[model samples]
Target: MAIALVLVLVVVGSVLFHVLSPWWWTPIASNWSYIDTTLVITFWITGFVFSAVVLFMAYCVYRFRHKEGATAHYEPESRKLESWLTAVTAIGVAAMLAPGLYVWSQFINVPKDATEVEVVAQQWQWSFRLPGKDGKLGTSNVRLVSADNPLGINPDDPNSKDDVVVEAADLHLQIGKPVKMLLRSIDVLHDFYVPEFRAKMDLVPGMVTYFWLTPTRTGTFEVLCAELCGTGHNFMRGTVLVDTEQDYATWLEKQATFAQLSTPAKVGALATPAKDVAKVE
Candidate 1:
């Protein structure tokens, strides 16, 4: 009786805890509420399986309890039971994976109208590059990475000369503008994640990965490295701000382009702005 009572309480207690839990996803600031919906679907399917399995075990223990002169039934696997289990398990697995496949399809296809933004991740730090007046970013190479050219943009790629570099600073995006984030890593594997954006992707040393999102609201969001890189992994933090059109333009103007930063004569003049930007969250 005590064992059966505990088994029933497990299901009831767990359900109550989940429904009353204060911990929940942060309010979404992007258009990927589909991600949250998919998660809930997954949870419900898995939770049902968990509860059913536990309850079934309890039922079996109670129904098959030994009695005076009772002998255990030695019947081996039943074909009907096996068939039912197989079909039900297949359906449950399909139900969990189907929604993710749909979300993944949307994740990789970037809209042509979306603005391109480059995100460069190194040990415990994040930098960003955005197209400048020419409306295109120049090519970059990891071999060219250095203190003077941290982003490694090809100096000869005229397309890159006007790229706005936001080094060691917060990235700002215009609210409602679709952005195709181009991710790269200089040192090791990292992941660019913003819970509010409902998106993240890995940064591999020799490869680039991408995901796109349109900022659906104006606010500042924390950037977290979702992958464990090294001892400094926990410190790999940054911020992204979604701004109004006018505010975005103003912030854009304040940032220095590659051409400006690379010029020796303008280096001294740029230091103050760089410091101010670095101070921002």
Candidate 2:
């Protein structure tokens, strides 16, 4: 009797705790509220199964208790009971999987108007690149990476000249605009995750991955590396600022383009030396 009461108490306590728990998801800042819905559905299905199983156990303990001189009856498994269990299990599994599949389908189907932004990840830092006036990003190769070109933008590519480069700085996005994020890693594996956006993707060393999101409001959000790249994984952090159209444009204008970054060094190296200038005069 005591065991049955304890089992029943466990189920009650769990349900109460779930209802009263203050630690729930942070307020969603993006347009992925459906993701929250899917999660809640999963929780409901699992919670129901858990409560039912525990309560049933409690019933069995009370009904089939070892009464004085009660003879134990043993019987082979019944096909009818086996069939019911199989059907119920199948339904439960399908209920949990269907929503996830639907969400994934929508998640990857990026909009045509979404702007492309490249996110380059290295150990303990983050960098970003955006298209300039041309509205197109240029090609990049890992082999082209150097001290002067950390992002590996192809110097020979004309399109790369005007590409805006931001290294180890905050990324700014125009609110209400859709953006497709291109992810790449120069070193070990990493993941770009923003909790408010409900979006994340892995950055592989040799290849690029992507995801899309539309900033619904203007605010600053923290970026975190969801993958363990090395000993400094915890220190891999970044900031994303969502701004209005004018604010975003102002920020973009202040960033240095690839051509601008390369031009100063080239001009300095080609400058006439003081001795050469004196002799020429």
| TM-score of each model, in listed order | 0.93, 0.91
What local distance difference test score does each model get?
0.92, 0.92
Error of 1 at 239 (Å): 0.6
Candidate 1 residue spans exceeding 4 A from truth: 266-281
Residue pairs whose backbone atoms clash in candidate 1: 138-160
